[model samples]
Target: MAEEPLLMNFSLGNDAILVQPKFKGGRWRERRGLRKATGPTGVNTDSILERHSKRQKTGNSDGPTRSIDYQRRTGLRHGVISSLFSYNPKIQSVTDRAEQESTTLPSNAPLVDGIDTFTSLGLSPIIASHLLTKLDIKAPTAIQKTTISRLLSGDTDALIQAETGSGKTLAYLLPIVQRIVQISEQKSKNGNDTNYQIHRDSGLFAIILAPTRELSKQISVVLDSLLGCARWIVSGTVIGGEKRKSEKARLRKGLNILVATPGRLVDHLEHTEVLDVSNVRWLVLDEGDRLMELGFEDDIKKILDKLEQKKGKSGAISDLPSKRTTILCSATMKTNVHKLGEISLKDAIHIQAEADAQQLLQEPTTSTDPIFSAPAQLQQSYIVAPAKQRLVTLYAILKRSFSHKGSVMKAMIFFTCADSVNFHYEVFARKVGQQNTSQLSDSTPELPTQCHSSVLSSVNNPDIMLYKLYGNLTQQMRTATLKAFSRNPNPSILLCTDVASRGLDLPSMDLVIEYDPAFSAEEHLHRIGRTARAGRDGRAIVFLLPGPEELYIPTLKHGFKDKRVNGSLSEDILRKAFAPAIASQTRETWEDNATGWQLEIERWLQSDSKIADLARKAYVSHVRAYSTHVVPERHIFNVKELHLGHLAKAFALRDQPSNMGRGGKGDEGKQDTGKHKGRNRDRSRNPAASDIDNARNSAPDPKEAARQMRKALNAMNPASEFNIA
Candidate 1:
């Protein structure tokens, strides 16, 4: 690997990275109007029996059971169904009408009603100072300016549009926090006469519903501190990845304001019988648009119906009225949002703002950014590259003149799916090897000679910093990765799905790569916006494959220039093959000729090493571990627009994951990297490549790979389970 071009810019190390959520103290409230079902329907009865039977079957089965994975996915499928049915028929009709209709709302100009201070937006004087001093929030962004008065005036049923990093989080949170504080002060003055039965389930207080577990935790982290000591007892978050029993145990006592995701909260609501949501007052649908996009309309509805039923009860819950407040905050709310507003809000006020907005009181810096923001500090551009050549193009970017302006920089490569990220990671690994060998053979000394090239990357894979982040990450692990990326000794790269695209604060990310851009153009904008934040200059690079003809438009393509789309290279098969295709290359291309080459090979054969480790730990492992990269919709013949057809034919086998890749195959991969040797593993290592070369017996078939991989896997027969993707 060539030494990276060094550039001097922002100081890398600083105070502990404080990534405050953009939604802190913003006026967005929880999505409410949910009620629990009093009795089981036929569907429920069937589901219970089905789940019980599944539990019994998996309970005794010991060989690589998928019970844990099924637990979450089962709930998810149920959430999808329940949420779909919970959308009262009226709302569904409205949704249908809106989808059929085409009405474009003209974009609004910057707000004239902007406030210069938090106090001007009704925050307490001390809180205002904290905003300016602690958070560096000098004034209100357009969302905050438009929402503050309305949310506080009790017209909480509203929807606002603004992208992430536009200070939108605080827009909904400030008012929520203020309202909570005021409620605390009021409750202190009032006695215990306020009944628990009248404890305001629906219209009582506030609940914020984010789409994913990370978003919930991110929001809850901010709220915990902002709410201060007085309301300590009133809040926390409820998410699926955490211990369900424990999270519910805390809520057993009840809470003033609850922060939750649509699915997990529904799970708790279904199971927790002692819960009361009658008096819930404030309802916020933060990122409600995303919920709809993720097919959570039904999940949201189930939650709302459960709350609504509890609130609408006649005799026992007489005090808690159906009348309540709701606030909807979305970066770009469309017809669905408007319809959702009609159902959730009671004659709500509309506060439409530019989806591409500016910082509070900041002078417009540049107006020509192809994306929006009168002066987007980020340099936004896209490149048209075939799926096969994106790895080369990204390498070009890392080697380009840009990003050299900054000493420490990060790139968040956005893929439509996690498997795509893995694909790119493999592709880059192959490309880097080809480049290193080419450079070394041509007398590029500073760049590692072909000898050290493979090892250089193996030791420090720039792509290793590249992680797969999506909605599936367990809550604890996701938070840890975010914290590490936020403030790290060395610059890092995060290969993410839509999970990190919106609302979350990923600081100092200087570049963004749209590896496989999303189906939605709005999504492309949000994905590219991770960098060049807070008045700092940033850059965006996009790679496109021509087969994506289904989602393209001429106008959108014009946003970029200097279009560079390189084709697939016939390179060494280090990793990056989409299909496990056969590719041949000379051994010397990466052969280490440093003194006794035979001895080195012999040593590699004798002891433990990371090179030997790659087969079980890298792309091969990912393909088995997660049945990803293939979206079921792509293969479904019904949807003409989404159907890959011919391309789908080429990957037909990838559609259904085999048992080996899915179960036993993945467990074996896990055991490979589960431990690290105390000594330099390579100094005494055996390359599996040699085993294949020496195998006169049908070139070391699956049995051999499985045998070699057994310790890396918990299962003896590793090929039994497989993942096609």
Candidate 2:
């Protein structure tokens, strides 16, 4: 019987060749004619086929046998070949890692056995009982234990510096509240003086100045909660974004404990006649470092001068402390913080919670420039990703974090500017199909009605909810957004700028993601401080680019006191993020889906002109904000070393960096029409018009001109009007 002819097909580059062998006279013979190649391009199929034909002619081996040998040697089998085309390194999914538990008390929690309870720290029994039963605060934090007694004395000004989330708020708050309550009780006991009885009409006795509006609101909330036991004393907040009329109404109604931002407080002091500062005794500057950084120095100086000039001018109202005790609270001690202390404090006692009370008292200046640390119970990690992979990597981190529906109930992602926050929030919302595409206004005054629905869903997680907050949003919107995110019990994510980075205590915040690094190490500390607060166990991770940004790791290690900061591979994160997709399809297919999804974002930018403009504005603002890093840390965050094109890709931008910020195709013809006509008229009038035009052209590139304009606008108002929603 004659053997059937055997045909073998081999692919070389973009071409393929067919070889047929025929059995004749009990021997196999090769067919010389080649079939058309149809494989990957760029490979030389002719030379490979020629070499195989020559080998066969020399009687070295049969064509099929040599091809089999070559296939085995080069791992060119179908499975192996397919794998080569879809090469992805395997890594352990983040889901497989064991959940970490808090082994140590929070840094703010009392480390020693002495003076653990609030009552032991000089708080009245009523206040202590209220704290324990109503607020569930069983004990005093280290800062509270050390500073409470001194602040309660009401004679010495104190500079309270402690790690973030270490109870600095209560360190000053409790003492002032305790004194007010005591004075009120004393007046009530004296039946002869009903006029001195503390009520809403009582003079404003305490002023708590916070750096951010959210923090001021938070402080007011905490004070209100504490005052549940003492209902007569009212606490109110005056922040920047709220209507001044309402704030004035509250001021006129009287607030025994007033919480305010410095700028707003100064404005009230200058404009409002009802704001009485003559009887003010307690001045608490919260987040002092941030207060100085936000250029509130002039406002704070003016406030101090006004307080001093009007202090006790109306005399004591109810036997409250006669002296005005200034308490300055900060996490880090910088030169500006010290200058702020000089402006607000007098004969100040330096107090820090990180050290022992005796040691701190003995060497008050030892921690003058101490490094700030996150909560001890916090698990801090970082991932170094390339610019192109940044967005997907972040998506993966969030996916892995919320993989288990109830495991991570809340997560916060911090960006550099409001524009970035707006851009990213919209991207994620649109990706999950939660965003309303029909909404034309990016600056929606209210969150979508769907956001209020408790049963929210996401593509990656079934119960995920998305919220965003930034400075550009209206004050009412910011307040409502924060309140909703805080109250939502389901798993949620908040995309925000540093507006949420100060002393605002978010509830059940299990994870904090620094999608963009802070300008300073101290600011980074504050960003991660959002989670793992008040002795609660939490996790934080930051994204760093692969170039000079990696150098920031050492700086972080130094700032965090060389804490165990672990590094995560972006590949691992990506793999884990796409695990759900991979489980449903082949690895290659799932990878393609992810790639296609990213491309879809690029396409979306191209199709939606409004979103495209927002994206460009966001990218420009991000690069500008990146360049404003603190001088000492500029080496690691140098903007000159950044790959603008790659970074633009992270924003789903396909345009060239040089062409960014310029008007789109539709606007190209319309731009500078009047100016061009003037130039043409000049050209027609004088021969030197060309030279003049040359000089004008040599002034600056469009990108540079746009950058200067943005800088000027930002200098005038730090929050960009273009950054909405």
Q: lDDT of each prediction vs. the true structure?
A: 0.46, 0.67
- Tens-place lDDT per residue, model 2, 15-124, is 35533322111001111222122234322234443454464343443455645544343222311111111222233222213334446545655444422366777888
Once fitted onto the true fold, the runs of candidate 1 whose alpha carbons sit more than 4 angstroms away are: 1-116, 187-204, 229-233, 312-322, 354-375, 386-388, 401-408, 423-466, 471-473, 532-536, 546-725
Best prediction by lDDT: 2
What C-alpha lDDT, on a 0 to 100 scale, does residue 441 get in candidate 2? 48
What are the RMSDs of all candidates, in order?
A: 26.5, 12.6
Q: TM-scores for all candidates? A: 0.55, 0.76
Compose the digit string of candidate 1's lDDT tens values, residues 1-725: 89999998867555445332221110112111111221223112233324434533433433223323332333311221111111111111001111121122212213332234566667777566666666555666655666776677764466665544555566788887776555544554565543322232323266788866666777887777665533343676776567777876767766767888766777777888755666666678887666655435656787788778877453332322246677787655455566566667776666633343333223333322223321233444445433223333355455332223344357787754444444344333323435522222212222211121132133233322433455434455556667766765455667677778766767777778775555455566667656655445566655533444323333234223222222222121112221122223212111111112222322332243332233223333232222212132233112232322212111111112223222212223342232222111221122332222123123235345334332222221111111011
lDDT of model 1, residue 271: 81
Task: Report the lDDT of model 2 for residue 701.
Answer: 59
Candidate 1 contains a number of clashing pairs equal to 74
RMSD of 1: 26.5
